[model samples]
Target: MGLYDFTFYDLIHRNAVCYDGKPAWFEAETGATTDFSAFKTQVDCLAAGLQKAGIRSGDRIGVVGKNSLAFFTLYGAAAALGAIVVAVNWRLSENEVAFNLDDCTPKMVFADNEFGETITSLRDRLPSVDRFINLTDNGPLDAFDDLLDDAPFSGEPVSANDGLVIIHTAAVAGRPRGALLSHANLLCASLHLNHCFNLSPDDVHLNLLPLFHVAGLFMAVCAFHAGALNINMAKFDADKAVDLIAAHKASLLFDFSPILGSILDAGEKNGADISSLRAVMGLDTPETIERYRKTTGGCFYVMYGQTETSCLTTMGRYDDCPGSAGRAIPLGRVELVDDADNPVPPGQAGEITLQGPMVFKGYWNLDKDNDQTFRNGRHHTGDLGRFDEKGFLWYAGRKPEKELIKPGGENVYPAEVEKVILEHPAVSQTVVFGIPDPKWKEAIKAVCVCAPGQSVTAGELIEFVGQRIARYKKPQYVDFVESLPEKDGAIDREAVKQRYGGKQPGNS
Candidate 1:
């Protein structure tokens, strides 16, 4: 560790002295609360135990679970020990989960009871995993608490620039790639957000998003850094969320699609008092933003960022620019560049690229991909956007090569889904794309061409795809077409989207 460096572990120690007995986090499932001083002690003990379990600096620790006290505790322990935490999305299929675990090849794999059986089934496939520890209490295995020890952490000092976490993004080339984030990346991002939100010890954050997601992980870190209380929910429940908000006077939260809408509905249905909520951040529809504003008089913050950027690159209140994604954040440089990597003039659409401390180190163990992504000294986001005269960023869409779909905020690449669809015997050609949906904000829609003399129903094809991949990646809407448009003997994906992307009768 450098003399001038300040890592996440340093922040935990600082908070222990500064905030001491103040509440740091609350687990909704267990109704357990841990204060800052005790939180630090727990993290230290966990770190000592993890070190004894053969975990060392630069080692990868796999975690697959929902938002919980145990999950965040592991994060703290990893940060202190300089071990990289490869947090896998629990919502993924067993195959998907195995792919992620094998990709990182963690020394120790920790999972909640829900995924205990799934991990056990894949034990043979994970060669590097020496131990599988359960994160919950009821699991029939070695519990995470068993790893706790009172011994002080005697590991080598960890540097701020050392890799801390690895979050795998949506598949771009038939498989997902892990983006490695360092301690400085996360600490810098948390500091930036702390300044942006004006967070303090009195603030209460309702953490509903899954811990495997960037938004969820970063927001929790930011709240913790600010000495704010984070109330964690294993999974989002609108009614339960409303009750928690009323009970805790939560000051802020991160939302995606129907979450904010459902919260409003639940608040009204229960006559719950949620007036304490001050700021809500993330992606949501304009109607829902307006409704939230009218109902609670709270600010709705919109942002544009990716997992590679440590969570956020730009953020601002929705009312500031009705349809814009806010302005560039202070800590990073956001530019709109053309294909040649030249800067585009204002009012023109171009790919969004970013650079700064907040930018991640690189994808884990993928040198060629890292080179291509970090070419020209900037991280190519593969997303397109434009800036207006007043400096507000207007998000256009994604580049063709990186076209993406988010059904309820989970990233789903059309190419991955298209591959699964084409596996069916009855499918000859298929095009998968995203379409606007009232509930999810964006829903996956598939336009398929069946093989000659072989027909398949939409339900049958959807089920076939679901069985092969994560259910969320399966098409929510399917349309059978006789044939797809072609250009130069190749399927024109743009043409297919333009012609059949909209909602159709009996498609859903």
Candidate 2:
């Protein structure tokens, strides 16, 4: 609450005055719109009601839902009261959802009506959760709309450095770790992104990504910070997205893998006019980027970032550097470091480290992890990359301990997948890795050796893993071999990848 401090609450208040009656957000499902002024009023009332419900500074509020007015309002209300919102990925399995909620120990849980049964079943396990508020109109629990009060918000002053949200990232070990993000982290990220995308009040943003993801939440916040209109979709429908763009003249959107591809296909097939799109940002294949650019005449921006960095650490137009991940953003310092914490020359690949305002607070409750990550005065991203002489970064994949695979932008660690594959009785040795794919940009592939007397089909093993974990984490391609290469008495993952890295199955 310093004199110069600026938080999301401050941004909302400023927009309410600056933008006034201008349309701020549009709900695609219901065709409802909320202007900036009305948005502020809703947030204030929600904040007052939440405070009355015993929510205080440092309190945790769990939210599991899609992109909706209620979801964004909860974010604003929590920020105003200095309460941290734990945004859970509703796409996860019931056990995974329960694990995240238990880890955060929220005071209240707000969820979409679709998850009423799931949350109700976990009520006994969540001792810290006092109330379960439903975000939708009809549900078994108390409705989120009922929590709104017209009374003025009266709570302790909030600081920009206070933790505002906790987003669980990919499991590096056995379970996902909640990454705590402060108000300053998100505000800085949004401001930087707004500048990068040249966003303005006249812009219309199509919110397609899930709010639980860093990219989704940051993009929405960036659009709001720019005083632009954000059209939110509870779930992505390619045809509906094209129609919305044509009808609303959306100027920007964030794409991952087949999203952009599907939009282009839908637009071409239906003769939909989507010429208004000016900037499209996210991870996608070169072919898709080229198609999007040629089809819509928009700039395809590339970036490299993690949840720990709040959002984009580096971003620039695709054509600017062609294949590189653009230059480091103005707000942050991106550097490459060797194993001993020394700087590496421009051309050599090394672990990526970040430092600046956009860096997140730290993992929610993992002190040892924070200590290791923040060592040497910079946040070790566990990702490897190299910078060219011109300063554009070329991503070189993740470190061994942090081996990751992003299928359609969702982080999936190889170790986590491998762990699940090993649980099958018919599997003796296995290695999981990522391979380039036309649709998902990257798809998980597993090479395994069957047990001596037990045999299992690829489909059976894939289904077994899917049932045990999130379906997205399941391998898209599986290949069985009699023996796998070994090094130092351990299964050599690198050897396995080198042999099976080809896009087609049974390549060896």
Candidate 3:
């Protein structure tokens, strides 16, 4: 099938038949398993219940839940019914959740029972919602399980072009913005991923990432499309992950760099039977990939993509391409374009722009921001990167705040230096800012919040960064703040910048 011509549920149904008796999905905490036949039945029933509730193809349905089997089922059910599913981050404040629910105007909300307080606070605010269903409860308004008790559903399938999901992004840390992704986007992304990774039905996927984020949901979709077993973890615990790998004999785990680092740390301290672990890949810096591969004895892989790109624009094909975010997946047009919107020569740094079936329609309602981001036909990725001679894309840094300058024209990217500085035992959160310096235009300054009960002097931090990164990139000035102001427990860039670039402050 062509990349963009198939509906979202089609992939799951097809894969189910391909590997019917095999385990399709399982919750690590409960040992509950949903094989192909059961999965299909539940999806149909949920779709029927949703349709019975007056939801139609274009209707938006919001789902706010933790990583559970219900999330996967609801997501598919929404697709089957041709409705758009908005995956709201459970980590956000009640006010934020209320704001998003009001803004999105979903037909109904499937909320996690754990967030009942948030729901209680925002119930009045979400007037547009026709119903509030508890994802876990079996009684009352549209309980996830009861709705899915039917053996099968005859509901009509939505087209591939139908809006599939609206995923909210935690904007550099501000009011989150929703990105509208279509069924075509999701289907193409999974298909492209399956082909690129050469996934087989025998593979097993471990899902620890949050389902609210693209990585978490996309991992499930990829595994489903490939007819692979998907093991869903309620949360990321390194020790639990190791145990699950050994017990389930999991083949591949879609993880981030930090998770791998933690697992590697655990592996070094307490041994693990990773014999069944075929691959370990996630979003990480190129340098971290090398270090991780060396430490794990070449057992990990690296993937590179953005949330705007449906999370699978590029990947470093396991074992084939060692360090590069592999060549563009089929049906994607990835370009390294200069500031002038002209394509740059190979190996030259430029903004990465992608045109693909998987690219999101646009940022929800932020037309000005959308125009700024999605210029012409391509989605401008704000990331600075380049394509190498072998067609591998190399990520450099973000276009905005790309460089951290020091007193002597020294330039550093926070992503690169932060990776190294984050290794320090005393640091919990560290942000490097370019403080104004009259002598050199700008000087590198570090604002750090230390780990609980751990302390380090300014001189010690400066030396720590210097030993890891270039000496010039090390902060000339260090400010040990009590705690960084966070919007919702996540780093707030604007707040950080305001804190560093204080009022009435200029060039140093």
Candidate 4:
């Protein structure tokens, strides 16, 4: 049978029947494990619990915490009964968290012990929350274990297009928008990923990305589709990650370059063998990608997608070709279009848009945004990119962010400049943005985090970039910092602007 015939719950159910005695989840730190049959049973109980609590189809339920097998069970359970699970980023500030809680107005929130204080402080603010099911015994709530006592769901909702998860955007431009992904969207994503990553039942997935993000959720779901073992880390511990890789003989790792570097270090330090890993998925500088490839003795797969696309709409192995985000995956059209919604000629940069089954349903409660995103019957990704003559797409930075740094009529993307600055030996991380300039409408400025116990002056790095790209593209001003401010894991440009480019004396 074709995969499109199945829903996410169907995938889980099949895994229980086909791979029943095999391990489905493993927690390295606690040595906790759940086999396929146990996972299916637990999900059934949780779904019935929600149904018993009067959660009807389309009700929004929130789950805020670090990664855990229980929360994943919630994902399946909620989806089974046609309820939507909103995974909240635990790293968000109280105000940020409140913004999401208010936005979704979830009927219930399953949060962990760490988020107890914030929920208590905002208790008066959250009118929609009926109850808080604390993962531990700390909040003004009942225990999560109580849900299993209620009953077990014998049947699931019959719709495949029903919404299942809402993954919020990072709010890089403004307020975060919750991208609603349905069962069809996820299954389509799994179909593309299962083929793109060469996944199989023999493969084991090592997932470290935050579960609140689409990447994390998609990784686990992809494993379930293959009926493979998934070793999901609650949080990345470089040393423990390496040990897990060696112990599980993991085949695939989906993470960023920095985290991959730490794993390589831990493996080297402990003499752990990671030869079992065949592919590592990430995006970074070409040099960084090659370094990771050599370190793990694995192919480095590069892909591009966001919450709006469910997970990844395009992907390719570096070993297949040097660069390029690759052509569109199955059942998708990856393209570059001008502002007029016209397709751009090959090699000309334009906004990247995806038209496919995997595209998300829409943003939750965001009417105007939904219209803007789905205007042309396509997910209009505000990020810019271009297709080569061979049909391989190359990713550019965000359109809004790229629009910020135009100096002297020539566009200079902060990302382009930041990439050069990161190449400097002393620089560890950096942010480049348009700072107001009297001469040029907006001048390019660089804020950098230097390597451990190492320093480089502003002038030296500016000259270094001046040599590589256009002199005008070089950062006119540079500031060295000990650390770059982060929001939702990525560098927060707004926070950096407030801290470094704040109002001067006598200025608004």
Model 1: how far residue 211 lies from native, Å: 0.8
User: Once superposed on the true structure, which residue ranges of model 1 sit more than 4 Å away at CA?
Assistant: 505-508
After superposition, candidate 2 runs with Cα above 4 Å error: 506-508
Each model's lDDT? 0.91, 0.92, 0.74, 0.78
Q: Please provide, for model 3 over 41-142, each residue's C-alpha lDDT reduced to its tens digit, 9 standing for 90 to 100.
A: 778788888877888877888878889888888888888877888888776556557777777899889877787666766777888888888888643445
Note each model's CA RMSD in angstroms: 1.3, 1.4, 10.0, 10.7
- Model 3, position 488: C-alpha lDDT score: 81
lDDT of candidate 1 at residue 381, scale 0 to 100: 91
lDDT of 2 at 362: 93
TM-score of each: 0.98, 0.98, 0.76, 0.79
Q: What residue pairs are clashing in model 2?
A: none
Query: Would you list the rank order by lDDT, best first?
Result: 2, 1, 4, 3
Clashes of each: 0, 0, 2, 0
lDDT of 4 at 421: 85
Error of 4 at 461 (Å): 23
Which model scores highest in lDDT? 2
Q: Can you write out model 1's per-residue Cα lDDT over 1-508, one digit (the tens) per residue?
A: 5798888888999999999999999999889899999999999999999998888999999999888988898999998889999999987889999999999989999989988999999999999999999988768557777889998666578999999999999997578999999999999989888888899999999999988998899899999999999999999999999999999999999999889999999999999999888899988888999999998999888899999998887889898999899999898899999999999999999999999998999998899999998999999999999998888899998999998998888899998999999999999999999998888989999999999999999999999988888898999888899999999999999999999987656534
Candidate scoring better on TM-score of 2 and 4: 2
